[model samples]
Target: MKTLRLGPWPAIATLVLSAVTLAGCDDDDDDDTPSDSELATEALLRISRDAPTELPDNVPEDLRRVTFGGTQYDLLELLGRPSGSRPSARIVAAYQTVDTPADPPPLGTPSNAVLPDYTRSAPAAQVYECRQTGGVFAWAFLQPEAGLEPMTTTPVPGLETLGFDHFRYPGGIDYGPPTGTPPVGPAWRVSALALNGGEPTFGQTLFVGAADVTVPNGAGNVPLLRLSNAARIDQGLPSDVFSRTTSDGTQVGYVLRLDTVGGVAPTAGCAGAGDVGKRERVPYSAGYYFVEVLTPP
Candidate 1:
């Protein structure tokens, strides 16, 4: 079968604009009515933007093949054609590990999840703090820490390469964690090298709060999360931490942590007084998709 490329995104946008114009020309008697062209264009736009770049003919084993419907996706593998572009299904299923409970919370997608603007993979550590939970002891989540590199997107030479002193309390206003509270939350940053022979700087910083929704990943693996961020997560906002951001996630509305592997905390160690304050970072990996934006030309 012959493929249709539809030129570039710019051309697609032009088509969508034309469709909107057509919608505006609907009969005045029914101003709310949408023209057929407008409806068709909207559907086409979604299809063209979201269709998988490649089908999931052979799912990699170590990618922690746990998805949110949520189960083994042999059917996806069976239906997928390896050599063709499938502008229909979002072939990359969902993420949440094996350890998720049998009667788990309903699975959900990230807010405003249409099609991602960029997807990056990260091999990371889910940092945990061993502490007393009421009377019993357990491993509590401290943060999901990772040094992000290119996963699904091509590496840009100067995209962001900088030193972010997560420990540095801005302007010497120390809250006194020794490292000064580490900016108040789990953070994701993109750093870029300087072009004009200056020091490298952070391009974007995402400080995310607790998950708005979650899905079980699998046995002995951490759960996948759709963390919320209305551009920024915390209220009052960390002046010291986010002040340096250039984009402030203007292009990125929200992010998805999918296709996970590993990162589950050990249950054995956090069982007693001796384990108090002990920290561990279980190795894990996930694909992160940063989604949709209103970009100006």
Candidate 2:
């Protein structure tokens, strides 16, 4: 079970361009026409990108072992073959851990009394079999497992309404305390989003709104966009709807891009102080909607 690490938040300008480019590319493709294998591969890549930092080591004891349908391949074997010239092309594995601490001891206990505590952890694994063909990397398969359950593609209802076309346990595996357990599967609730689009726009105003769905980490209550007036204008967009202020504040914004998958755009929106205090409003075209999770200090 290999751990997955996500890079820090991408620059605002880069994110905007990437989103525009992806939206454009998606517009050019046929709708809902991806092959079953292609769909599986896409899901695997999403899981890999969003997997947690660590996974439990106790195989069947604390973790489930599932075999994905269609193909069976070990981690070493998947990576041994050449993925291609591009750096994003390759098979990857990711592990996530979910845990919660036991409740605290009662107040009137003796000074020397020992306190009993309950602490437990569970693990989930997702594997991505992908390759870089024609300069763009795409997943060929996705396998997920939990304990000993048979691997199957279990549909998660309403996922598409939330902007996800497919949602599955992958290996027909689900693990956690029997119902009514606190903090159950908190750490294991991994969610991933991927975009394979064209070149991004240099200066554009993009809007992203969350579809009605269960918030991943009980964070649904938090506001989606927290914009600092100052930071907004500093990034080069409109100062009216977004501007800078003397008071220290935080704003919620969506990610514009995660990683570049195709030809790089000639020029991306400006970052740093180049466009500080300047206002620009660009038009938007229809395509795939951009989704990102952001927290500001």
Candidate 3:
């Protein structure tokens, strides 16, 4: 069979643009760590000039096997084709699991009520990144809309096993311990869903207040956003919350974003700064930092 080369696709860029708009920062200020409100206000303050670049020759080949440390070409060979593209960061190959019901089930419904009737849906897409050494593999990511999946009687190493619906690099690997469940109260909710309605999209209005947070417990040592005055316990906001699973099976939820000051630089003890690690301290004079409260489960 002839390999199918993917044409330039903009979906990834759209996703990045939407994300960057939320997390874009202004370096004019020299503050080491700015307040969340300050960053939020600044995010609104700075006008992002990054228009989506013109599409490139983003093509793909037939993917036979996907392995860690494989080249981008190797990935094309395994996944069969590329579905989306971003310049140097990554390429995406999308697979449609099946025609999902217009609505699967209201999130937060009783597991017994929904799980039995629910058919697993394929993740919208698989993101792949190329390494300096010319290898490409599935890149991990967090989806704010992905509802928290509680572990069954048997706990799995990776969160994906529970049908959490987030992306991970090297596939089937958990960053740390799995998040079970979190304490019930002290959560935040959206006053209004979004300007256009439907689940809130990026650049939409986000009204946050202390409410019951519904997402699954986030992994520890992950980068998170927090208000300057927020509590420092549990590594504070923007770091790790619900870092571990409780004996009773509860998962904690925390805010996470893909952008930061210095444009996702490398961190100590992290393979790449992009890897969700510990609370990322904005370097001195790094300017205003922006964060997005992860979407409710």
Candidate 4:
């Protein structure tokens, strides 16, 4: 199981940036504090400094399996994609050659399900409350508390975090059922962590509907879920904004909760009316795939 300690981290990020920039400078008396980009890079390096480089034989080369800082992300479900899965975004498919048509269909799994925009590792809790539903007492799912860490790829093995920075978010997974409730509708209060020049940056808040597709993972773990995006929360930002902003990633599509570990509500916890207000926080960790569209824009 993966573990993460959640708390306020601005001070920590600032300290990291200070220490790194100070150590690198000798007497260059221009700028002491690092840029937002530099600070972001340092934070990303610190978090993923301990991931194992080697992957199991079962994992595909197209994907990554990271075990960093005791949080192992074996995205087992994404390993060997189906034959229907393709690399083309729906936009490209929509513009199929009426004038200059390809002799063959574009390469890869042909399904509308293209690869993810990027993946993240979230060690979260599936909060549940014993509420009366259908006149019976049961454990109803509440919101999820998690911190998202962007997964990055390195051209060289040992130099993974050197050039890449995966920003960390002290955030939560806000959920509401697909019927579209008013109060708790947004799916993720968590900042969208998107990559900028190999550095992960925080973007806007993501809105999504709950569980459009649900697949049972196991007896002891939470079910895999697909939460479709509700809006284009982060869109039309300037490319030049990447350097100035802490994050500039557009996130308005789908969120897949694949490769789950735990967080099952107790089957026997709520027995009667007496247990109506009981609460439980089942611990879980999942590999989250964030997709912009059926294909990238």
Model 4 per-residue lDDT tens digits across residues 206-226: 334445667777898887666
**TM-scores for every predicted model:** 0.44, 0.16, 0.16, 0.45
- Go through the candidates in order and give the C-alpha RMSD of each one to the true structure: 17.3, 27.3, 23.0, 17.6
TM-score of 4: 0.45
Ranking by TM-score: 4, 1, 2, 3
Tell me the whole-model lDDT of each prediction, alpha carbons only. 0.38, 0.23, 0.22, 0.38
Runs of candidate 1 with Cα error greater than 4 angstroms are 1-123, 152-183, 195-204, 207-210, 232-252, 293-297
Quote the lDDT for 172 in model 1: 18
Ranking by lDDT, best first?
1, 4, 2, 3
Candidate 1 vs 2: which has more lDDT? 1
Off by over 4 Å in 4: 1-29, 36-38, 41-123, 155-183, 189-204, 232-252, 294-297
Model 3 Cα lDDT, one tens digit per residue, 234-270: 2111121112212232222222221122212222333
Q: Is candidate 1 or candidate 4 better by TM-score?
A: 4
Candidate 3: stretches off by over 4 Å: 1-106, 109-161, 166-253, 259-297
| Worst 10 contiguous positions by lDDT, candidate 4 | 90-99
Worst 10 residues of 3 by lDDT: 87-96
Worst 10 residues of 2 by lDDT: 179-188
